[model samples]
Target chain A: MWQLYQFPLCPFSRKVRLLLGEKGIGYEPVRESPWLRRDEFLDLNPTGQVPVMVDTDRGVALIDSTVICEFFEETVDKAAMLNGTAVDRAEIRRLVVWFDSNFFRDITAPLLEERMIKRLVHRTAPDARALRDAMKAAVGHLDYIDYLLDHRTWLAGPTMSLADLAAAAQISIADYLGGIDWKSHEQAKRWYVGMKSRPSFRPLLSERMDGIPPPSDYDKLDD
Target chain B: MWQLYQFPLCPFSRKVRLLLGEKGIGYEPVRESPWLRRDEFLDLNPTGQVPVMVDTDRGVALIDSTVICEFFEETVDKAAMLNGTAVDRAEIRRLVVWFDSNFFRDITAPLLEERMIKRLVHRTAPDARALRDAMKAAVGHLDYIDYLLDHRTWLAGPTMSLADLAAAAQISIADYLGGIDWKSHEQAKRWYVGMKSRPSFRPLLSERMDGIPPPSDYDKLDD
Candidate 1:
């Protein structure tokens, strides 16, 4: 059996979980708060990050969300998320990086730092300026998403791909933290609603981070 | 033909260049200073980052270093950088991320900020403490490299892979910025020297960023 080490709020971990769900891969979810930098977890992944996949019986451990995604995409033939030609795959991967790096860095990361990490680790109030900055960045990001949806059926191309999963994962976390303002972002909101209603994303929306409550419309499909 | 848009000191671009060199795929190097955030470049990539591969004739723009490397690996298949089974490839990619994200964050990014960008963009002096911290981090990173070399021929495994390219690219930039100290990292030094002697790496070592002189032994194979 496979073990997935992750916390409820990590976007990268969520990305892996969504991919696993799509691929019909089963694994035991191991709750791990990477901020604690647990020694055992650090041993599994020197980076001290979560969303680590380990199979103790096989003595196999996969670290990094992207690495894990690529591994299963290679090992399992079902639900090809990185689909299409080499050029198409390149475009898919490009957006994956865009969401993973740019979207995370600009929006999700800051919200986590302010809303989640500061409250949990430091036991302090989040900076008002920082939260505002993240939410503002989210507006711009949603604008970019709207721009993308204007052209392609999906984020990357005609078919669904890892890009959708990556974007949804980050957006989910941002929404959970109350960083996203969905007003005036009809296209992005509609796209996100489609993503939120996915079977793979349902479980993620239902889960809550301890001591932190999401906005009222977080899990509601009608919102 | 392809146009690779990157500045000389950009480690991600160097990684792509190494892979292209090994695969015998040709690309025209187009100078791009991402920090400047030029209008045309921003239109090409909203991320405002280097290592963007474009073919105007085909209207294809491959952004992100990993995306570019994977594209060529899939399309060309001659050099086969992402070799081995799924697990092995995962290990290789994990290390690639290690160098690209962690090493770049702890060492290269700070050093570039202190030594290069402060001088170029801000016209300010580098913080002594920041330089000290980056060099200190470089020691730990080089120790990790030594540990990896103790167990395997290459950083990832038996053969030269994109992992080596990623590590060497970051290290080369760090070395050029005078952030790396080679006093105790004998194993890593030897491995890096081997990487330096490769024909692909030779051009990178010889190229210098304007007004920033590298250390005297920066290009020497004897180091």
Candidate 2:
């Protein structure tokens, strides 16, 4: 039996969930609120971050979504998310880092913090200046994604990959906050529409957060 | 021949440089100013980030330091930086992510921005508020490093791994900026001293930036 501790709306957690689904791995999901800093959660992961996977059968615990995903890639080759030659794998990993780090830093972090976490955590209303900056940053990223999709069927290559999952996961959070302007980037929108129709992404699309409802077209399969 | 485009003071770049040295692979160094967003450099990496690796022999280019390091781990086996079983590798990777993301976000980024990048980029004087927060965050990280060192010979296990390289790369930048209070955390200092003494780390210690001089003890092997 495997158990995954995760937050419902965390992009990192969503990335892991999507990967697990794609791999056809079944695990019990445990929702964790890292902001609470619960002792037990901290005990499991000193960092107090979610998306911690406990492989009960293996008698091991893994933290960091990317690391956990890589572990799966290494151990289970049945449904490989990182399939390819060394260069191809590097391409996938590069985009994974880009979405998880650069994209998250520039777009997801500020928008999510302002739109969601602030309200949940009793912080003051979202900062307008921060939102403006995030909005500007997001356009560039969306345009880049459009450019990439123009050349390749998927983000990194022709096949589905962790890169697609990662980008979708991060962008999904921004989408839930109504940050993504899908119409502006048709190619990227088409790529995302393809991702949205996949069975692996179904669960994430159906997730609902109280007090912050997603836009009507948020979960739609078509742009 | 391999050529690595890097910035001398970038933590991610240093991480790659350290991993390459540890792996016993030689590559020509190409200094890149990512901030300049040179057309040629941006052509290789749309992100305009430093630490892009070009393998002339293989006719491939790779970006993202972690991605590059992972590529080396996959393709080269000379000095295994990811040495261990699956579980062990997960632990090492978790720490690498911790240092690269959490540690960098909390401590190293602010300190470097204030103490070093400000002068290099001609930004305004360091923001006092940011520096204060970074100082407080540094203490928590230093304590964590001390705790980890107390239990293990090396940061993920008895053998040196990318975990140490990543942590050291980030910390070395902090040290260069004179942000590390070595006297406050003896065990971490001792561990860092071990890392610094390695032949792999020699090149980084000798690297000199134009205006920002490292502390006198920056390159010292022994305390």
Candidate 3:
């Protein structure tokens, strides 16, 4: 049996969930609020972060979404989600880091801190300066995504891989916050539409929090 | 032949260099200042991040230090830097992410922004507030590392792995700025002394930047 601790809105958590679903793996999910630093959760993961997976069969707990996902790939050795040769896997990993680190820093993180975190923490209002900077950076990132889509069927190559999942996860969060101007980048929007239609992506598309609701078209498969 | 574009003080860049050195792989090193954002450099890596490696034999350019290091492990398959079983590899990767993402964000980054970046950009004095916050966070991080070192021969296991390289690279940067109080963490210091004595660590220890000189004890293997 496998179990995972996750927060509904964290892109890293969403990426792992999608990977498991795509591989047709079954696991129990436990929602975690890392900021609260719950004792039991901290016992499982000293990092106090989400997407920690407990693989009962292996009798080991895995921390870090990337580590957990890659562990599944190595041990299970099925589903070939990382797909292809050494160079192909390298390309996929590069794109994963690009979305997880680069995009999150310049766009998703600041926006989340202002919009979601402020609301959750009962802080007054979102910081205008942070919002402006993130939105400006988003334009460039969105354009880059569009450019990548123009050349390849997926972000890294022909087949959909972790790169696509990582990118879409962040974009999904941004879309829920009404931060993406999809109409401005048709290619990127089209690629996302394809991702939305995947059965593995279904649960994430319909996710909702207590005081937050996604946009009306948030779960739609097509424009 | 492999050629790596890197910056001397970048932790991500250093991580890759250490991995290559430990693997005993030969490569031409190109020093890059990512802040300058050179056109040719940006052409090779759209993100313009340092530590991009081009394998002319493979005819592919790899971006992201972690990705590059992992690629070498996959292709070279000689060095057992990530040696051990699947679960063991997972533990090492977890620690790598712990250092690269978590530690970088909370401590190394803010301190670099205040101390190193300020000097590089020819800006005014370091921000006292940012420096204080980073220092406070550094203590907690150092304690965690110390606790880990108390239990293990090396982080994640009995062997030196990418986890150690990733961590030592970050700490080396902090140590350069005189951020570490080695006296406070005896076990961590002892482990570091062993790492500093390794031949793989030699080049990094001797590195000197234009206006920045390491503290007197920075390069000393047996202090």
Clashing pairs in 1: none
Give one digit per residue, the lDDT tens place, for model 3 in A168-213: 9888887787677776988898898998999999988877877888
How high is the CA lDDT of each candidate model? Answer: 0.94, 0.88, 0.86
Q: How would you encode candidate 2's per-residue C-alpha lDDT over A52-83 as one tens digit per residue?
A: 99977878999999999998888877668897
- After TM-score superposition, the amount by which residue B16's alpha carbon in candidate 3 deviates from its true location, in angstroms, is 1.2
Candidate achieving the largest TM-score: 1
TM-scores of chain A in all candidate models: 0.98, 0.96, 0.95
Q: Judge the docking of candidate 1 as incorrect, acceptable, medium or high.
A: high
What global local distance difference test value does model 3 have?
Answer: 0.86
TM-score of 1: 0.99
lDDT of 1 at A186: 91
Residues B55-83 of candidate 2 have per-residue lDDT tens digits of 87878999998889999999999889898
Ranking by TM-score: 1, 3, 2
lDDT of 1: 0.94
Candidate numbers, best lDDT first, in rank order: 1, 2, 3
DockQ top scorer: 1
lDDT of 3 at A156: 90
